[model samples]
Target: MTSPGRTERLVLPGVLTAEQAAHTVAAIAAEQRPDGAIPWFRGHHLDPWDHVEAAMALDAAGEHTRAEAAYRWLAAHQNSDGSWYAAYADGAADEPTDRGRETNFVAYAAVGVWHHYLATGDDAFLDRMWPTVYAAVEFVLQLQQPGGQIGWKREDPEDGGIDRTEALLTGCSSIHQALRCALAIAEHREEPQPDWELAVGLLGHAIRSHPERFADKSRYSMDWYYPVLGGAVTGAAAKERIEERWDDFVVPGLGVRCVLPNPWVTGGESCELALALWVMGESDRAVEILQWIQHLRAENGLYWTGYVFEDRAVWPEELTTWTAGSLLLAAAALGGDEATTAVFGGERLPVGLEPDCCTQP
Candidate 1:
């Protein structure tokens, strides 16, 4: 890991000066309501997923108390099923309207909680969160199909119908990590969670062995890299996947596109691609991706969602929390900063489990 000072040196020049990054992070921390929930934009509603993502960013910035408070908000609001409702309007935790319980979103909390625990080594926080994580995984598993794909959601009345059992590589990949974290938490508590292991194996199998079982979502960069990002494949296979698709979405001096011919290069996808490259042991390429996004940072250290292909600066609209969070994570991975290293549990990229999806017949 880079020394704290060096890591700051690496990240400061391009995005924000180290001092400015710290101030910007602090400003984000201040956005959290007294109740501990951080909304996407000031006074905007807080969704479960983005709340956790922002909290993880706070944790990455070394604001552990704020991060814990964010988790506390989620804990206080958790439903009897150990899941949070899909959405909560600002200033209204007491009467959160459900967008209904989404399986993927609910399951993501485990991954976030585990990530926080890894960053801070806070055993008490881990203990408090384990039950919630386990329950959330169970709820999500109820929606899993025998063909190894998840049904996307279980509770929404409309579009809630099982869309397709074709496993979404991105969703399954995420669940693969969440299950591993949940299992680790289970083991940490010295509890037996056979079911959790089974869930992990099944999800891993779906991601590794069942590409055909998923929808052919080749247009998105996420579809190209998520299995690796989620830790479902590694070693030679990871290299092959990236090599095969390298040129399709990458735009020189710009960034990766969310989808081809979209003519819009997005910060979030670019950062994620950087992280994915890091996971594949391609540090130099990862740094290249980070450098590309460095050109897109705003003065406030925030990033826009996407830049138009024709004129990079034209559509600087829709500054996003996740865009900033993604850049922070990518910087942490590539620069090996103490703060990012501490929060991410390592300076190197995470090694996801080898799912059965990669197993040959």
Candidate 2:
């Protein structure tokens, strides 16, 4: 792991200094179990999506071995269907707290794996993780609706029965990035996956052109920026989407709101929005967003999950690894970290073949 004064690329003006970045990295590392599972915090539940997220941050901070261990943990605990349970109890022998398997959560392993491979250039690690990525992508694609949107989750753990009544804009947009990363891995190994290409193309179309296909969660900040962040909505459309929701979600001197009509600001959502802004070539605005959220950083370098401005207090009273993880990732992107930039920038990632039946938005 990077020592103090060595996290150069993780240093952003008002976001994280070199020493502060190292401390944050160490804080997240300290929370990881010997078995490599990273829960929300000690005695808290571990979700697969957030687990992958924290691991990606570890990689961004040059903690490659710890990141690899986190990935290995995922490979070991994955269910036979190529998915992981939505939640696992921390310090409870890896028992699942939630039996449901979410498609976006399952697909995120590919994003983390590809990020790690890019950061380390370890072909062996890529080879070891390819099957896991392949299985995960296959599992997620099984839940894809005919309209190119992904169903949120499988409610029945035994039979994998999906509700399929609604797809989430935020979740499907996230899966779009995962699909591209999965395709990149396959392409690296010279393994052609034509089906995945088609799947991704259709998913992108759905995200850009068919907002009506997803559940209506426009009140949340994630739905506003995730399409651009996830690479499904890009170029001029990406800027337009951000502009549409800018006033509704951003809170100026504070951070971003988790939901509208609420004075609550969350570190995770704020940092993610900064990442999306960076993707859209708005680094100045991204830096300012990161700056606004500095008030949420705790003394030990872990960040508070959120702050409720109306109450003028930190809600839930817990510091989270994922929140800190997001901060580091967004800072890395702004500071010109190559791997983080490439992953979020989406310029080099494979765009799966577009279906001729659906016109581009």
Compose the digit string of candidate 1's lDDT tens values, residues 196-255. 666666666777667777777889888888887777777798899888998998987888
Q: lDDT of candidate 2? A: 0.92
TM-scores for every candidate against the unseen true structure: 0.86, 0.98
> Each model's RMSD to truth, in Å?
4.0, 1.3
Mark the 10 consecutive residues where model 1 has the least summed lDDT.
343-352
Q: What lDDT score belongs to each candidate, Candidate 1 first?
A: 0.70, 0.92
TM-score of 1: 0.86
**Residues 225-309, model 2: lDDT tens digits:** 9999999999999999999889899999999999988999999999999999999999999999999999999998899999999
Model 2 poorest ten-residue lDDT run: 156-165
Clashing pairs in 1: 208-357, 208-358, 209-357, 231-352
Model 1 misses residue 302 by how many Å?
1.3
Q: What is the lDDT for 330 in model 1?
A: 69
